[model samples]
Target: MRFRRYLDILFVFILFTKTTFAQGNSCTDDSTAGPDDPHSFDKAFDADKGYGYVVYGDLYRFDCCGTVKRWDFSIGDNGKIELQIWRPVDKKGKIFKLIGFNEYTVTNKNRKSGFVTFDVPDKERLSTEEDDVIGWYAPGDSLIEYTDGTSYDGIWKVAHDDNLKVGDSVDFSGGLDQGSRTYGIQATLAPNTAPKFDPMPDKKISMDINVGTTIYTVKVDDADPADVADLKMEMTTKNDFFMFNTQTGDVIVQSTITVPVGGQTVTLDFKVTDHCGAEGTGSLQVQIDYVGDPNTTPTTTKAKTSKTSPKVKTTITDKTTTDVKTTKETKITETSVAPVATDKNTDKNDKTTAKPDLSTDQDPSNGTMSAMTGGSSVDAALIGGIVAGIVGLIIIIVVTVVCVVNKKAKVRPSGKDPEKANNASKDNAKNDAKDKPSPTDKKPPSDSKSTMNGKPHVKDKG
Candidate 1:
């Protein structure tokens, strides 16, 4: 009987052990599951089939007995998490609507079955951290907490459906995430609004008239797409359009008016408008050409005419007239003085003009003229005076010859005179003898001369 009790006890112990093992190894079913079963299974009977487990809040895994055959979560096979629906829940558990989505993904080497999953209950699901929420509150789309701690601020692209559950695994193409968890939903982007731009008008137009060529330049800061079209320019002279460039805003015209030479000021009007109902009008006063007065001939002029013959004739006539007048005056003066000169000569010969005759006892004719009175008498008297002068001259010549003959006779020596020199000597000797003592009477000489010998003679003479 004791042996039979031992067998029964062994059977009970084995059954208890088996029940403990089965309970320990069984997997819990989760909403976040892969293609495998999503419910718990009998570990003792169907351990080789799929089972459920959870990772994070929205990821799950399925194990075949001891091996995990498949895994998934609200995140995708790329280990990305999807926010099936995220909204702000009030303290009473009511949800508030907002605008974008939040989702993310996780990848690691420890992932079996190519993925990881998790089942998140209502309490385990990520709640919006007040600081994590963004954008305006709305309905059907919003961002929530992600596994990566980031949030999605984009618009909703996909609506919530049966495929998306509280803890169902969802693959998100867009959203925010942290690790294996994600928040918010996918959203489509609104069409981008084209940038608004301001229209620009043409500016700073200038014209250069250098070297007889007119260059026009149009300056512009910028232009809108619509304003860039419909730009035109025209050039005019004297209110007439000579040339124009409509497209490029360049206008060059051949000018009929010559450019002024010095300097001139002109006005240019430019009318500009764009398609956007914008208009600009400008006027420029440009200096153009130079000008001068016309050529003119001198008004004041003079000519000089001259003749040679007439001047010579005038000079000769004046000289001849002067000579004739001088000759006539000279002749008249000479004729007037001739009578007076003759009378003076006759008066000088009159004897009555002289003192009374020295002798009164003279004949009338003789008394009137004496030796110089009558003409014939004067002539005969002159003849007699000349004869007397000749006779006196002859006498003087005879006297002079006689005086000369006598002087010559006196100086001549005569042989019959016995040579006066010898007679003079003998006379002189006799005179000397009469005047002096004879030689015998001469006193005896000094003793030196008395002796007739060769003694020196000495004598005293006065």
Candidate 2:
């Protein structure tokens, strides 16, 4: 019986030793496992560094095992434990720790199925510590207490080796420790919000002028008043026309009077832009008056010639002349008168002496006579035929003289005047030769007859 008892004890001892060894091996096997190890846990209870232990509450502990468990105790619940924990060691040992408090208003069981998320603080001041917190819990410790006061203790397994992405979900198990629990807490990754931007609007305005016209058509491009706010236009006239800008691009007739000739209009355009980068434009139209060229009267020129009347005069004279002439004549008649007185008595006595007296009586008689008569007649006539004939002759002579002078002035010698002079000189030389005596006249005087080369010569003198 003693032997059997010893055998049983030894067998029990061997079984116990095997179990302890297997447990210790299991723990040691997962100690070096990474956080992402499928079989290892992500969180655990740390007692030496006091990172995940509650002073008065139950100390929930987690290991590298795949199982999730929780230990409830008053001291573990009261002990201060950081809400967030990270483990860099692959071995199931907690390496990093955070300090924070947790309120207990509800049991750990009621705090399951939700997550704790951190966001930018709304009113909390940032700490200047080396590990300053950029964000805090959204609901804060109060909201965490309101939701459920729970102590978490579980393994926090990294689902992936990559850092937290923009949108990642973390599952929290129901436990209180440095590990993420599926029931106690949960976390959701959200994308950061983008900033708002407001840009100024783009605007442009332009104007064009057409010479000599009051009316103008304005063209606008990409113009919208609502897009471009605060637009103003001012127009001024230069020379003949006024120009200004309106809200829209259009032709506006601003002048009521008729446009003068060669007149121009001035226009101005002002545009503004809105905050949305839109543009608006306007144009001004000016009416100009037309003026015609000045009217001018043409001057006339007249040629004048003075005229004078001829003077005429007439003279008359009257005169009378008297002339007297006288002539005397003598006559003898005595014998006849004496004879009549003595005729009676003497006839008787005279008869006796009558013969003797008759013979002696010689009667002598003489007579003288004169006559006068006067009358005169005169005749006058004009004859200019000879003078007219002489004048015609003189005109003919003048014409002849002019023609002769013209002919003489145009006379020219052939072969130039010098050639003609040379020809004349040649003619004069020939004439001189002809007028010169022959060589015989210069011969020496030889006695009557001269002999040359033994030839005899005879001469006769005259």
Candidate 3:
């Protein structure tokens, strides 16, 4: 008893799983709107259609989550046809009752032939099994026929039945059909699904590619079994250099994609709609990088250096040397050499001393001592020549004065005439005294100072 109970539970679980799976996988059926018939019965007889009933069963099995939306059935009479679901009485689907319908009607006028369609109510869903029956009823003067045959037999009724059972045998004696009915059932399904890209790997593109080149072709699909009706792609950010083809999901390079950064990513959203008008969205990412051309060799740009401007650099170096020479000795030496009289004199000295002018160009590798030494030598030679020239001029002037004095001495009278000599000497002395302005000389007022015996005396006032 325990084993049987477990088995039963397992069966129920399997059945529930099957139902859920079927509902989840539901799709729009495309095969002629109805189930296929394995047998064929091309009969050409019109049934007496005065409020008659005919019931047909599907040859194949039907799963759950099926909705009968509309149907297509052909008729030869100018009348109406009514359709309903057959509620099953047992698991075998051998007995049923006409319990569910919503008064869907089809009117035919003047031999209206070919398949005519009528919409069913939304609430009416068909929970069916293999070879389950679907019933149809027509008013008077209407015509219906069997277009195909199946291995299984169908039921027929001249009048309505609240509850009906599929009996063991059916003969023409009981007025029942022997083949499958020709009708189209349009069943729609609701599936839980979304759209997705066809699992594309990430894409990469080099910055050197030309504009309008196809980056890659992307494809989108609906997870449901129905056909995707509309497909489109949109970029998250608008880029002037890139384009996306909405219909085909092809990302193309419209213009140059310039990036200051080396690498980046472009993203887009993709949407697809199934035939049932359900939409789904997904995302696509594309990586972009600055890559050189594959066919050409890459080269690097070098920075500009001061080595290129030699003149400017040399001037700067010279100024730097000048800045370093702040010592007192260097200053004195430079100051002494700075007073150059002429470039010609400087050149002559340079030749004589075998020393180049300090201002002239020299080996840049030489230190500052070379320049300062050359300058000091030139200055010393210049100062010595000036000093010697001044000393010689002074000596010539002194000798000329001495010679004149000697000549004057020789030209003087002899000492034989003593008195005359003495007078002359006294006159000369007086003249000399007048010219020299001796300290004893006084200004004559009303009374003047008189000298006696060669000595100065004060004159008294009387």
Candidate 4:
């Protein structure tokens, strides 16, 4: 009877052992266990210096939409780190999405090093979903560098399922101790912004020009308010007539531009690049032509001259002879003239006389001229003789008058009768002679007979 009782108790013990083993195996074998399960860490190790508890930090998502075929991260501490993915339920619960529990070991080869890539599991992609969180459980304390090169003491980020677009910011927080955290990280989608050309140049440019001159300036319009002082300008076209300054965007004429047939056009291509490697493009076109040339020839002119012809004159003469009391008819010609030159181009009505011979001779004795002449002339020899006779008679009358006046003057002084006056003169002379004593009678006295009358006369000596 006791043996039968012991066998029955052994059977009950075997069944109870089998039931406990099955329940334990169910918890350990379940790969899609939810976080609410009491034994959720059945596959996880205990928290120790070599292993740490799983930490659910903030959620992370890609800045843009993309498929993450591979992932990499830096290990700040030397230990194994397990990357886990979680998807949110309706309200506040989360479930583990298996990635074969991708885990990596950090050593001297990969400690504080570059990104280490992880192997993705088969038939399962670490895709992004809303309310998804990429988490990490570092078995030890660690640090990570921010985009600004600032190091923060914490566990590094893994992956995110954010829905933000490119160039949008993703701000998150991290902490060395789980419950105490601060917003310290931000990342932006690649290709932050597209470049643009603000304040673009004018579409068409116009200018007026004089020939043989140059256009020395070009316009540049760049609306970027940033520091354009260092912006670069490049002209793609190669033309000898123009040169451009890349530093200043100034276009100058290298030489005088020449116009071609059917006019001409100059095309220029310009590109501006900023310090950020973003670039903008623009173009310019110019048309030019030559109007005309500006030089000509000259001509000549003449001056005028005026001349007047010289004149010739002639005179006629007439004469009558008084020597024999007769008037004679004789042809006489005298031409008083000055030297003159005749011109054939002179007016027909203008009678220009020929030049006369100054060496011609004329008669001097007769008051008549016997020279050859073309016109009729009359001699005035009779009138010349009468004039000479009247002059001589006048001269004789003057002389006779002068002589008679002289004779009268002499007779008046002699008392009107010369003979009687002469006789009276003789009588007066005799009387004077009788009354005058002669010089001979009053002679100087000498010792002679004249002194006998007792009168002494002394001879005078001078």
Candidate 5:
């Protein structure tokens, strides 16, 4: 249990434990807390089977691996012992729990009788790191001294109102009391405070990475909860691609990883240890990029011929009328200005506008063409200069509305001569729209009507 908040939230700094402690130095296992080492007949339990319960008491560890901060028990038994420190998530001795705790009480008195020691402070110290142990609890029998056979590693007991805090997680290694003997349990080491990481950055692998994929989680940063509780994903150089997690530094993708084509790289290297051996390294890379022959068909890249795109297109077809350009299918071509226009004077109503649709608006690869000549036909000088500028603007609006209706019929008799109607409107505006009336001498109209009789000098302002 992350040592019950010994440090979390991405640890920032703190590397202090430079060894130093002296209650009988040399790593103290016997710094004296005696009454001749918890034995008044060495029977803290099995008191002839009146064995009350709740107690783990002995297993111990402290072969110099650091910081226990003092503990040296021996007890007589008034009650209340609590001094746990289990940290053993399987170093092979099966499972174990409770991270670090400390309490101490003993009043009245009875049995073995003797020292006590304690100090523990630095926030419940006890951070052994390798098989770590050193237990004790109380709610019954005398309180110290045990000595039976031997197997240990797990031991549950509960109920003094369910007590066993600090993330309680026991196993008891299946009891029948295979053994239990730890006279005045001890621990005092001191130096051992490493573990760091939170500065990694060398990963670079954007996208494609198959085989079971997970890729990276490790962040580690510290203040020792026994150094970020159990972390250890070391891989200085091992490959088959990936697969981390030596106690959650997670990292997966175990194989089939590649990088070698038009562009390539590979990398990998790793490290992040913690059970007191301390480490923190990184790298990952990957990078690759080929692309060619993706099923062989992706080559569209010719776009550099610009001098104003639109090399001529206007194709408006449809046999229309008075330039009416209609024709959702049109016909009625008896020319010579409708020369007796047959099909019963074929005039199913004419009048129309809007153009474009010369078979898909020109250039179906040719037709009214001009894809710079690659599309053929129809460019007879850009359609004869756009049909002679729309037939000279429809013959000057039909000879200025027929000389303003023949000069308004000689000034309508006397709506005032007004200087002889301004000199007959300047001689009927120089009368000359080819003297009017000529659809080859008129007669054909009626394609339902809308014909300048087919371009009579192009006059059909209607």
Candidate 6:
């Protein structure tokens, strides 16, 4: 069943004609078809196969599919030839239907002796799948060729009927005549039509397509699959990078392509032969867009960090041959120096003390002094020293507060006997002075004042 569908037509325009710009190799072949080269021998069938009977010496297939343009045969004598063609249905073949038949009067000039031609302008197409029996008989003389060897199955002869039409199935079961023979018969073939490319006339690609990439697999739109190999292609490349793999029809990049600095267009030209005697030309374009190269090495510079440490130096002066003493007030001075520097030479008599490197990153692996280079150990020592100093200060404050409280408790509103308290205070004062550091210690000089009452007093040096 056939159904037709209609659509709402859009605005349409008409194109008059098409003109092809360029072309490639044309489909052109001038050769004869037979079991072997018919020209290689000159022997002819000198005997007649009788009138009113038909014979066929052609039953093999010609692999290259094309159109049978003409018929050729040789005759040594003047005769009449009735050509017959039977279409094959299977390998065994049949004489059921007739597709072609023609009668030709052979004379010395038109159909000559050695080899002659009978043009079949209709150009009956040849099939690669099966063979067409080209049989002919002579009501006067059927001139055949005597080749040295015969085909697998020799020629067959069958009785002819004048009433048989083109579509009538004629029975040849009882009319078979097998013989070792050959015909002067021959035929010429040419391409039926022009072939085209499957993918339009152009292909577009990118510069990013790497080498060895199958850019576009070549394909053709042709009617005959058996004649595909006979179609030749001509490819022209502006860039040597591209090539076609003939065996596989793959267009590949064989090497690198020189791309422009920015976006640009590059093209490769190609052409192929059609099934007919014509050419089909096409082109492939490549678009190159430059980004950046990853092969360039970058330079970098590292920043050097400089560190400083506070340097502390203690000096014993001539005024203090003994240990220095802390009075009511203490003074501190700090000095800073550059980071630790490596020394090739050392002063054996040096007495200066260097502080621990608190910023060192590596674990100490040497002696106990080196162990202090770690940040954790140095921080702990500093915390311990500060705590000890605080404890000593608290003890001094408690002692001073107790002395003041004792002096207040001994007071009796200035009415009790002052001599008893006075004598007890002198005794306490002598004991308190004994607990203090020796006077020989280097203590800052200050004025000392005493009161005549039975109470203690402090002297200010400000």
lDDT of 2 by residue, 197-229 (tens): 122123221122233333444433322222122
Task: Give the TM-score of each candidate.
Answer: 0.18, 0.18, 0.29, 0.23, 0.28, 0.32
Q: Write the per-residue lDDT of candidate 1 for residues 1-462, one digit (tens) a residue.
A: 999788777755754553233212322222122223322211111111111111222122112111111223222223333432233223211232331223444444412333233433322223221112222111211212123322321222222333333433332223222232332212211111111212323232122222234345433321222123333333333433124355655544434333344445556565554322234545444454432221321132222111111000111221321111000000011112211221110111111111111112222455322222122323443433443334334334444454567666876767556476778979999888777866875775554555334675556565
Scored by lDDT, the top model is 6
Query: Considering TM-score, which of the candidate structures 5 and 6 is the better prediction for this target?
Result: 6
Candidate 6 TM-score over all chains jointly: 0.32
| Model 2 residue 131 distance off true place after TM-score fit, in angstroms | 33
Worst window of 10 by summed lDDT in candidate 6: 10-19
Point out where model 4 deviates above 4 Å. 1-229, 292-462
Q: What is the C-alpha RMSD of each candidate to the true structure, in Å?
A: 48.7, 52.0, 21.7, 37.1, 23.9, 23.4
Cα displacement (Å) at residue 35, model 1: 42
Candidate 4 per-residue lDDT over residues 1-462, each given as its tens digit: 999888777755754553233112211111221122221112222233322222333324322211233445543445666554433321212233432234567676655343344544422333232223444445454322122111221233323333422222222232123332221211111121112333434332222232334343343443332214435668788887667777656666665455543446778777765433446676667665433221211222222122223222322121211111111222332333212221112111112122221211223353323322223122233433343344334434444455557556765854357778879889999999878987877986554545424886454556
Clashing pairs in 6: 45-144, 193-276, 195-275
Error of 4 at 186 (Å): 3.7
Instruction: Sort the candidates on lDDT, descending order.
Output: 6, 5, 3, 4, 1, 2
Give the range where candidate 5 is weakest over 10 consecutive residues by summed lDDT. Answer: 304-313
For model 6, residues 65-110, the per-residue Cα lDDT tens digits are: 3456666766666677766655443223434456556667777784
> What lDDT tens digits, residue by residue, belong to model 5 across residues 1-462?
686355532221121222221112223343322123443334454222222122333345444455667666555455666766665443334446677666777666433345466676665565554334666666565365555434552334333324557656665555344234435555555665555566545555532445677766666665555446555666576666676776676677776544444545556677765555556676666453444332333343322211111122222222222221422111222222111222211112212232221222332343432222211122322443343344334433444454567566865766656888888878887685657766655776544534454853543559
| Stronger candidate by lDDT (3 vs 4) | 3
- Candidate 5 C-alpha RMSD relative to the actual structure: 23.9
Q: Per-residue error at 386 for model 2, in Å? A: 71
Which candidate ranks first by TM-score, i.e. highest? 6
lDDT at 113 for candidate 1? 38
The residue-level lDDT of candidate 2 at 12 comes to 60
Give candidate 6 regions above 4 Å deviation.
Answer: 1-32, 39-59, 94-96, 110-112, 122-129, 194-462
